[model samples]
Target: MRARSTVLAACAAAVALLPAGCGGGEKADDAGASASPGAASAAPGPIPAIKPADVKPLVGRWVGTAKDYFQFTADGSGVWVRGGQRLWSGTAIPEGGGKYRFSWQGGDLKTASYWGVSLTEKNTKLLFAGTNQTYTKAVAHKGKGKG
Candidate 1:
């Protein structure tokens, strides 16, 4: 009779500990819910493609004024102004790798400009590591139209 009680008590202790052990870990459903869909999974629908010509509309003179105003001409030349000082001026040359090299002269500064990939129609951000400045501006065309 004593042996039977001891076995029953041991089994009860194990059953109580089992719930605590399992609950201590993260729940499987929570992990699955937070996971993102696989990138290689089948496409839900056709993806629209943008051609270079479609991007041509973005090529033009864009001007803006706030703390500073800048004029960016995609054709060949561009300029930026702040506090009556011309911050930048140069010729913009577009390359294949979403990059543009600009040869500029103005504001006691002279050098070639480096522009990264275009972000949007109205906004273009440029980073100058030498100056440690990130320039962000909303551009407006001189007369062609709005972006």
Candidate 2:
């Protein structure tokens, strides 16, 4: 029962994190990125397919303003961190149309959620359709363990 409650709470947090696009987009600044112009519009269509190579630019540790982050790996696997603690293991599945689904596993969320990406002057920006929050690629990281 405790596990279920935790999962439910986590699921609620995910929903809260993404209230706009429900997931994520890409940028075209000659940098590694993924997102569509209408990706966060009122209505969405089929997401574009992504290649492993294309996602390479997005692979790395992304830090959020409040210390939340995403550590994406080249093998399509990733870890989502919040408040310095590991939240869940995630899979970055590329859905067609410049959209990447950030699905959670081995934790609270089991459903697949998508997100888009955009390149910045210094780092990369990761955005989900629902929430306005963005995860920027970190310049320096101390590794994950619960800060």
Best by TM-score: 2
Clashing pairs in 1: none
Clashes (backbone N, CA, C under 3 Å), per candidate, total 0, 34
Global Cα lDDT for candidate 2 = 0.50
Q: Kindly provide the TM-score of model 2 when superposed on the true structure, using C-alpha atoms.
A: 0.48
Per-candidate TM equals 0.35, 0.48
Please give, for residues 47-135, the per-residue lDDT of candidate 2 as tens digits: 34445676676688877655467787776567666765554454566544444665421111222343433434443577644344566
lDDT of 1 by residue, 28-142 (tens): 3222222111212222221123344433433543333223443544343455444555544543344433444433121111222222123243436553322223455555437
Worst 10 residues of 2 by lDDT: 25-34
Number of residue pairs clashing in candidate 1, backbone atoms closer than 3 angstroms, sequence gap of 3 or more or interchain: 0
Q: Which stretches of candidate 1 lie over 4 Å from their true place?
A: 1-66, 104-124, 139-147
